[model samples]
Target: MSAPTTHRSAEEIGRTLAGPRPLPPLGATREVPLPEVVTETLPSGLRVLAVHRPGVPMVEMRLRVPFAAPGSVADPAFTARAELLSSAMLTGTATHDRVGIDDELAGVGAELGVAVDPERLLVHGSGLAEGLPTVLDVLADVLTGATYPEPELLRERERLVERISVARAQPRTVAREALQRKRFGDHPIALEMPSGEAVAAVDPGEVRALHAEGVMPRGSTLVLVGELDPAEAIAAVGKVLGGWTGAAQARELGPPPVTAAGPLELVHRPGSVQSQLRLTAPALRRDEEGYAAYQLANLVFGGYFSSRWMENVREDKGYTYGAHSGTEFVPGGAVLGVETDVASDVTAAALLETRYELGRMVAVPPTADEIEAARRYAVGSLLISLDSQGGLASTLAALDAAGLSIDWLRERPVRLEAVTPEQVAEAALEYFAPERFTGVVVGDAEVIGPRLRALGGVE
Candidate 1:
């Protein structure tokens, strides 16, 4: 050894002759430009939107038919019937049996399916670009002439009942049902999952009747995006789906009752080890001017993993594994919801800290670092969500349902970039105030009930 090695202090190693090196400035963000789109309404009253996104030789398709049930839809069997109809619709059509239908789609590397909610029934599919005609023809066959055969219906009905039973026993599902009731009272939106008994009672006649009544063309939308010519695509859709005719405009669910501020309701779940905490308040819709700022404020609150709520409740205190807050767009408005799950032993402690974080959102608001991070996330997420052809197709269908066009989506990046810290602070105070939130807590009554009652503002 030449000499004994001596360790240098970190400060000595860090200081350079030219002084501390400053961090390199951040690079400018690259923005992806949107492609041109062709939009038109066919003679059958179905709106068609097509875009030429020439990347992969594949195409994505989305069809949205307004299936909002009228007041008369409260018929005891209506919800059950609607659920079964969505599952049974693709089992067979007049032109082809179930196997034959699948074979046609398989030959073209295509898959199609339907799902329903309180608002609409969405038919989604994808296929090779050259097989557009085959896909459209299959869709048309189902749309106008699906026959809910008894054998298929019987099998699907049993599956539905089993799924419903398993889902209801879940903690998250229990919380969702309780939250829906608290927020909407007796509104149809609160009736998300039909009882197992109701589903078991549905027969083929009810499903066919529901399809004829709800699956109309006038207010429906179809979107196709991939390697194709937009103009040709629109013409093809019109020619293929020309026979899908309906006279009346599809009904839409009216705006839900405004969420009111009140005390928390304790929905009892017996002998639970974990408690689900959910909270909700009013928020601005996407079309509203203040929505951008509100969106940023929401992120700083609990919308992301690094958010203040997460930092306090998870990193700092170790009370829960994860927490979240998000905006849900309803018919005419939007709402903010915060959710988390914590062990029953710490249920009261978690609630106190949650309320404290909510109060701090209004009192202290977010710092410059928090605001900048949330704004950047908002911009980056919007761009990423619309980056692919399938993503773009789905976005178009959802926007069409809300009476918005793709232009609204293209401008979102700029809108998020322009939101100022002052605006976010104002929105935090206006909307995130603790008094404005009301929701349900799902946990064991014997374990958490007394602590929750002692906490007050909870019953």
Candidate 2:
């Protein structure tokens, strides 16, 4: 068939597309009931939280033990000891060698791994629901009886030192380390890991001692998510871990102040060809009244690909491949930041545009359409994240760590929907103002430094 000739004008088509069309009414929000969660504080002060999700045949378990060393984070020995301890915890225990532990995990089609940051040592285990008992038993064994065998510890220590070396050589890692030190100074919450030499100095005895002193269940939280009875899970946990005893309370690094204030902090990487830019500031807790508005504001700024910041930096100017901004929670507070990498030639221009976007968001409130789009994206992401077993498990663990409950999560859609354009603008004014941000730019000092210093924000 022959096509008919088009007679519609471009303006007419544009107007028709821009006009609102009738749409179906939205259905009432389907509220998923909170899972049956059983929480108990055992005699040893371990807080065990179990939830029965009842869909998938598998289970997810997470144990967060407060492993903060008593010494300052600035102490190389302290950082080294904590890192080696986490790496060695699951290498062996009293009765199980490394291979034996792997065999037990494989028997149940499960895997357990341990990781640590400044605040806690996290043991993550997952398996089929039928293997819950085995999972718990193995976890208990590692928690209470890890031996940190010398050969395994030494091998892991060497591997970690090598990894640290590799990480330090990367530009992003260098920028991150500089940002951490600039933001927190010598505070324990600074993101610096131990040096390679420090890791080499960590002996097996130190790992064992650190585990004995810091890897206690008292004040720790254990979250289990799976297709099982919550009561039964709790009982299983108690039977396995209840007798474990410790007197130390969880160490809280409430919130680190944004120490890299005043001008932008420049970490000079001589003869570099690119720059990593970080703009950061302290933010509010997730449960704060302003959180929803703040969330929307961040989305409108750079939290997603289609945001104004991304459009400005990546699409319009071609300054960078990607740009993003997001928030991370601490015990009682949050840190909000923007990150991007740019070629050395465009580094100053990109930084200027970033600040301009920050100022624009504060000065000119987002349009109604912008507000609705941002709000929907934020709320939809949250709901979608909890739709899977692993997602729900992680959500529960994270919120619990923040002292929030599942009910708070359930209520977030309404809260996000309630946020008005004005609220977002207000949040932008408060949290995203250019002056609220302290930054670090890692690049060729000769190329970007004078331009940055001339911009007046670089010290």
Candidate 3:
């Protein structure tokens, strides 16, 4: 083959490859049947949401308990105690020691994990459908009969402290911590994680007490999605968790207060080679009507790989390897956040470009093509995320907490499709405007700080 006398430049080749093809006529979305959801509140006040999803011979369980500490000023050690408790809860129970518990779970091809945030404690796991009873039994044993053995508590505490130390040294973590502090002020939630000293001070007695006080059934929700019948599952849950009762209701802290945005803070990380950027603002919850528009707007901006933010910052400017912005749902509300990491030399330029893109997205409404691509991605990803048994169960638990049901979830694609470019533009104007975001950049202050302040917005 003869070489071409003149080769097409990379830009020409790229444009040719990226040129849009005619979109086929959209087809009617195949409706996935909503699983039958049966909800039962036990006499002891434990709420159970059981969904019968056929096909898989596995059961996924998700439990959410309102585990926030009481008072505006949480005990300095509360987070530490809770972390230790979550780690040690399954180490040993009255009926089974740590080894025995693991062996029993292995026999059922199951595993369980406990996690805690400021607002809730989550217990999640999966097992064979035939092993549902065994899983529940083991879970109950851990919840009610956990011994909080001293040695296990100490081991977990040390491990967590080590992890926290490593995490605290990370640029992303430092950025997040600085942003939380600036946004929340002295609020207890601003603490994020406990100090290493606090973790070391936590003991078995404190963990046991935290479990006894916060792990009650009144405000906890158990969600099960599997091949089993919903009614049967609910009944089984009632039998096992019926006697686990408590009078104390889980405290519901209303939504966190929203701080006015646009104050950029700098977190000094000495000798850092790269800077972590995080821009965040208060956002709407999934249940809100405007949330659909907001979500589409986010996807079109930086929520996806092919978004405008990534196209500009990574593909065009080569300022960062990756960039993303998305909404994170917490107990009462949501926060929209954008994140990226860039070399120290380009930190200011990246921030400037980020702000420019944020402003431009609103100034220029998305094209029909952009809107449709984002819509398809949003709908397709939602379906894919719920394709598995575990994903379905976790999604159910979260939606239930938000007072939504499976039927609502099944209709998400339709809602996503209905989001218009006008709606996205409006959402961008309201939520994604650069002035509405306050954030932090963590880097070597000597390298990036003067330049950041010179760019305006940074204080």
Candidate 4:
């Protein structure tokens, strides 16, 4: 056998032939030009936004309809019907059976999906550029005339029931449910997922009725992005979907009761192997002034893997696999949520470190280095998010839902660059203080309860 080759150590390989290689300067960032968007509201009341993104020969579409239950407290019956409606929406229309619908979509190299949450119903689709008409036509056919056949309803109801049962048992799902209830007592937005019993009660007639009442044209938006002319795409969409008419406006979801900062709720999940540490507090909205500062402060704290909280809680202390914090927008305002999962044994220690980081964020505030790093990351990530037609389409749809236009996105980088260090510090103090948050600690109470109670912030 040949003698084993002498191996170079990683450090030796990394060395230049010199003592140490000098780091090259970063290339200057070039300003990216945004595509001009075409927008119009059809006579039938559907708002259409189209933009050209000729990077690839594909088209992406997104439709957002405010589909919340029209009340302060969510009606479980309506929530269940909405779930069943979304599942059955693409099953068939007046002229096509389920397979026929599939065959037609496949013929055009297109596919579509529908989903519902407490806030809105979304229909997202993608296809070859040449097949945009077929996609829109099929979408219109379903939106205007979905007949929830009994057979499909029976099967879908069973599947949904099974899915809900499985989801309710998942640790993440249980934590989220507990957190929602802890944050907003009985608000409709807290009902993120329907219960199994609620889903089982859905019937075809009720689903069809919800389709008639909730899936209207007004207060809804459709966004199209692809390798095509913007004006031509907008006109085509309006022409094709002109028949989807209704006088009733889709009900909009109002903002929930504000999250109050108080003691951390301890929810017992006996014999659990891991504990979930979830914390949340109110933050600024995207449209608000100094929002960019809030974004940078969030990044410096725990919005990215290289954040302070991640360094302290996971890297230094070995408390978790990962830790994350980010801003989540609601109907009107926004909130910052920080969360991590750790072994039950380390639950108390993790919570302690988490609170320490939060207190540091408030008292010491982010340094200039941290602010610059976060700003660079914020600008880079924003550009990356819009680099694809699908991403652009999705972003536009979400912005429209929030009553913001593409101009906000186009100016985002400049806004981020202009955020002052003082603003970031102010945001940190206002949003990331330990006392500003309330949340839940979910795990085996018997294993974690004593230590958490000793920690004092957690109840």
lDDT of 2 by residue, 2-39 (tens): 99887977656556565844557554343545675788
**Per-residue lDDT of model 3, residues 283-352, tens digit only:** 8999888888888888889999999999999999999999999988865778888999999999999999
Worst 10 residues of 1 by lDDT: 23-32
Off by over 4 Å in 1: 1-24, 27-32, 72-76
Whole-model lDDT values for every prediction: 0.88, 0.83, 0.84, 0.89
Predicted structure with the largest TM-score when compared to the true one: 4
RMSD to the true structure for each prediction, in A, is 4.6, 4.8, 5.9, 4.4
How many Å off is the CA of 73 in candidate 3?
3.4
Clashing pairs in 1: none
Model 4 CA lDDT for position 174? 91
Over the stretch 102-161, how does candidate 4's per-residue lDDT look in tens digits?
A: 888899889999999999999999999998988988998999989988898889999999
Model 4 lDDT vs. the true structure? 0.89
Error (Å) of candidate 3 at residue 360 is 0.4
User: Which 10 consecutive residues of model 2 have the lowest summed lDDT?
Assistant: 25-34
Q: Estimated TM-score per prediction?
A: 0.94, 0.93, 0.93, 0.95
lDDT, model 3: 0.84
Positional deviation of 71 in candidate 1, in angstroms?
1.0
Look at candidate 3 and tell me the lDDT of residue 138.
92
Per-residue lDDT of model 1, residues 302-353, tens digit only: 9898899999989999999999999888888888999999999999999999
Worst ten-residue run, lDDT, model 4? 25-34
